[model samples]
Target: MRLSTDSPSINDSKSSNKHNANELAPRPTSIKDTGIQESVLLELMLKHLLSGGVLTKAQLVNKMGITGGIIQELFDKAKGLAWVENRQSSAEGHMRFALSEAGDRYAKQASMKSGYRGLVPVPLAQYSKICRLQSSRRNPITFEMLQNGLKALVLPNDLLHKIGPALNSSRPVLIYGPPGTGKSYLCRNLNATLGDSVLIPYAIAIGTEVIQVYDPQLHHAVDNNNESAQLDLVQGHDPRWIECKRPLRITGGELTAEMLEVQFDSHSRTYMAPIQLKANNGILLLDDLGRQRISAKQLFNRWIIPMEERRDFLSMQSGEHFEIPFELILLFSTNLNPNELVDDAFLRRLGYKIHFDALDEPLYRKIWFQVCEEQGLSCSEEMFQHLVNDYHHLLEKPLIPCYPRDLLGIMGDQISFMELKPVVTKALIAEAWSIYFVQA
Candidate 1:
């Protein structure tokens, strides 16, 4: 049965505990606020009661993520139909409830169809609405914004300016460079520069199929414990939506072509939305691009249609298809040559193809001191010069930005192992450098 937003669900009318308007996580006040069908919710409640055997009204509310009054209304409805019975009073003002024989049979049939029984899921239609409303393209990035976001990192002005515009375009970014040139680092900073935040649902329901969306690993929630925001929760924003920083999801060499599609568990009768689905309205970085088990050509082929249409078609085992929004900054970072990985036609699809080259002597030296300062080690100019001139120049090795941090890390490790104060000496530099570079 369709859930009507016009009437307040049982608990919403009685609850006086209101949330502040500015509160980041506004608790859903009613069944309508959850944005899923009431019939689906009724079945979920029955399943919970069947599995739990007996549960308090408050416990059911907590388990279902619905307000107490709504749970009360559901119990009343179930009791009237004899689908559930109030066994006894578990606690003061809390009634213990259990499924009736009919309810058990109904739950069994429901479980046979789909074993989902958890948080009341937001309908896919509602999820799509929220995603489109909070699309990353809506938030524009300025040069100043990019600079402020990456202020912690030492990036050159030329590179900064180029990145500013590239990110603003909101198209595919190809960050190609040799290893240790900070291609991945730049992509991370660029993602931060997108600024603002987006709302992500806890889970999405398509018919009876529920697909979980909130991942603690991928989604970083904003600190919303402010007094004013808490006070504003009285009216309540939808609890299903979580205010999170625009996600920066990274995948490396382990990624395969199958991972790009919606994954279903036949045993559990549930669907897990793909990475791109979770990555909607943010940046999805494919790190070590060409190194994925799936060849670059195969990967590009998978993305081409989504790239052009700005939507992806995901299929279920039952041959059901869903067209989901494809609105994220797709970033591809690789140490390998772009030409060798994907042909020119695919390269044309990328809006910005920037190359990160090894650092020059001046930049290299600047980074050397920075690494020293960060590592709490003293920098000796003589030692740095000796290493650069004698080792880098003499050996014909290019100075890469990552070398300073890496070499100093080894020096620090050695000092720690020996219980010596960390200092850059010619001997120490030589030792670290020797360990860092492979013998030709």
Candidate 2:
């Protein structure tokens, strides 16, 4: 069945899929580390060496069929990734760089992993190859980039910092907390921290002449004709790929095997890459891991192969299978037991599974103030004590007034309607509680 272009949605719901279940079963470690570019570069060097250990600089250039600058760049890179030794020939007194044993072994392993049977012949048309190679290694999000990409509310600094590094540097992170505790907020902000370069806000395809935004939901022209059609068209995107930047994408509960699989677009006549596929080189935060209609165990099961191999399988509607860069910081946020969500077997494979317990009292206090200042309310010690003693302590709430602030927000709005003073009183607080809090 066909799915929506922006997110995965089916016109029919006959075929269902499992999402999250049995946390402790230890998910099959869908922890595929992205190292495609490195493998390619290593193979390039290996081919250069397999022919002969002693090629002159000119021969090396001609063999790889690349320019001098490219050769030197590859040479320098080889020196770092592969072991090389220099020897002076007694006959000609020229330096020859040859792969060390470790380098040879590494090259072979890299070649095998990349599905390269032998060496790829150097061709000028290989430019697309380089771009695709870069796609996997590319950084999809960055720190400053995050600041510009969000419309959702930002969570506390502590929460952001606690889970931020794991988004890129660590493995799949599990963010667990009760509902309305800002779990989704953290996921939304992930787009902001993605590297700006991968954001590709806009692009004018060399073939089409039409300017297209890097926006995945919109851009579909992949050929010269489409580009040409789009070129004369108005609605030229701003901050084009060269300028526009949005790398991270958040998916709450729309993840599916089909989303993980490939779909051929009859309209576009091309394969519509899945969300995670597009998330390559960026963060793909799976918000509400356990709340999906799909079963947790089944979702974990689908991801098992990808986690272990750091690569995933995608099948066309015609049943043709292919692989793509699963290079993304996959984050799973849940309030349910991590063990209950997945089997222990599945959980162990996850790179880093961190459970975010309830926020402590002091942190709760700090966040409450943040809510006050942003909402423009004058909160005094008397007011604060009244809250802790009269309401917060009595209700045994999470202390930060996550819901309390929401209620107060309503009161603040009423203030605008009634023209009351900004300094909120117990009456205002009571009004907020009535509107926001769910009484037992």
Candidate 3:
């Protein structure tokens, strides 16, 4: 069974809604959208269902990068939207879902909106709201705190001045560079440097209010109106630890549009936010910019509204759109050309674009020696020069300061393997580079 994009619904048609109010509906529902991006594989399965087929959780996990928990989240959302109809086993014990009238509409909308996208910066506007509340709750970081953090990084004088005002104001800061450039490291250190405790929200879900259907503890006191009855939110076993430390959501290229949306549960009927929502009030680093499945332009287009306005709109699966704050330090790390990646209009949203060029010879030497001393790798100046001058020529690559750190690591592994003395050698460095980095 395969779904067709051109030919509209061949079977499931939206049923007529007649009765209201006093009519005893099968289920009282709140049509909220679950902003989770349905994976291509899942979409394929749904398309198959439209043509007439079924999928088990096992088949789902095998096809998609999703796990049982995430799949359940999807099912719950669909069930709430009334997009699926449960059918009893005709001759087998297994149960399956068929596409419903609402499901067809949902599928069509999903197809129109779906495309594997990047999650980085997509949730900036959403996170902004979360941080505003989080910041207000934690109180703002004073100037002293900000200055101390900047000093600790030993940032260049020019860079410090450029970043200081941005920090003082509400403008977002971006750090662009290659891998191992310490982008994430410096951002994480912001919490400690700020001298403030960033609050991490424990998303206390109000269960799919099948009139309060989601029961986490089997005996939970979930109340929407009475702010007094606080739901005890626990991710895993025992439900004790709060896990409330402010988090830095480190996302690679696995980001998408749906992830920026809100979700609603059908069975247990609750909402689970995307990772960016969870990373609210903290730093969000799009570690590898060009590596995502989504085009850099497509992603930048969606972010334009949120970045400029400091507010992003989130659509509920129920088709309701709401605005959220865009609180976050959006860092785009890539090795690609900036001009080629994003245009002028897109670039304007970012307050600061700090490009970290390859370290010069002097800095390279300093970094190399610092790493070597820290790692306890024994090698004389003569040996270091020989390796740098020799292998670098053979490799035809510039002296990346990171090379020494990588070479030291390789030497350690070789020593451990061969049972050699505690020292590094040109041979070890050469062999490791050949194995790991010599591909290109």
RMSD list, candidates in order? 7.1, 19.5, 16.2
Residue 72 of model 3, lDDT score? 60
Query: lDDT tens string, model 3, 1-440?
Result: 11111222323211111111012111111111222234432454465455445655434433332334554655676677676777665445645667788777655655444321111011223224334654422334444545665564433445555554555445556677666655555665665443322323223211111011112322122122122211222122111111233445666678776555566554423355654455555556776776776777887787787667666666655565556566655556676667778887667676677765455556566767777778877777777677667776565667654566777787778888999877767777678778757475
For 110-228, candidate 2 gives per-residue lDDT tens digits of 54433222212222122123224334224333333344444244444555445545654535667776776766666766544442323222221111111121344533222211122
lDDT of 1 by residue, 173-200 (tens): 8999889888888777766565555667
Count residue pairs with overlapping backbones in model 1: 11
The estimated TM-scores of all candidates read: 0.87, 0.56, 0.56
Give the number of the best model, judged by lDDT.
1
**Ten contiguous residues with the weakest lDDT in model 2:** 17-26
* CA lDDT, every model vs. true structure: 0.76, 0.51, 0.50
Q: Which candidate number would show the highest TM-score if scored against the true structure?
A: 1
> Which runs of model 2 end up more than 4 angstroms from their true locations?
1-165, 168-170, 199-214, 218-246, 265-270
Worst 10 residues of 3 by lDDT: 13-22
TM-score result, candidate 3:
0.56
CA displacement after TM-score superposition, residue 32 of candidate 1 (Å): 5.4
